[model samples]
Target: MSQNHTWLEIRELAEALYCSVKSVYIYRDKNLFKAGTHYYSVGEGKLRGKHIYNLELCRKALLERTAKDSRSNETYDNKEINKLMTRKLDNKNLSYRK
Candidate 1:
């Protein structure tokens, strides 16, 4: 909600993201970005009832989510993979009867 942030309509947001308007709506529906926090609805006679996106807020939220996902899915080294595989094999062998 900084003064420098540009407010965009759904179409404009989709255009900025290189996506369809429906996709933007979908993101809104999925709560990937929050309303009021990331955007707000204008209740003017001219605008009727269309939400406006605070560009910086939306971009920041998306980037933070992306960074969190990347950290959670951190790449494993060969040794770590080998150790996980060994554990899985051992568990599988233990389940079998002689």
Candidate 2:
């Protein structure tokens, strides 16, 4: 295995996820990110917390989560709704589906 980077921190994960530090914790609370899947702690449950994550994987997870959110049965504002509609119309495959 490769040597772990000591400088890689949670902030990097936050940036990779395009989310705030608080949101990362919130996602953690919601079990949005699986421990071993997206995150790895150098020292599990220690005073000095150290976690090494695969940034690429974290980004992929975040994107997938956002996609799920966008497709959810939830209300959206006019701006967002219009944008989604426009995107759907512009997407050739979706446009030709019907």
Error at 28, model 1, angstroms:
1.3
Runs in model 1 deviating more than 4 A are: 44-48, 80-98
Candidate 2, 15-68: lDDT as tens digits: 766778888778666877667776766866687567676676666667888799
lDDT score of residue 16 within candidate 2 = 61
Cα displacement (Å) at residue 14, model 2: 1.9
Estimate the TM-score for candidate 2. Answer: 0.55
1-98 in candidate 1: lDDT tens per residue?
Answer: 64798889888887887778897778788998787798888887774488999877887877887899889986889999999888745555566558
Number of the top candidate by lDDT?
1
- Give the range of the ten consecutive residues with the poorest summed lDDT in model 2: 88-97
* Whole-model lDDT values for every prediction: 0.81, 0.70
Report clash pairs, candidate 1: none
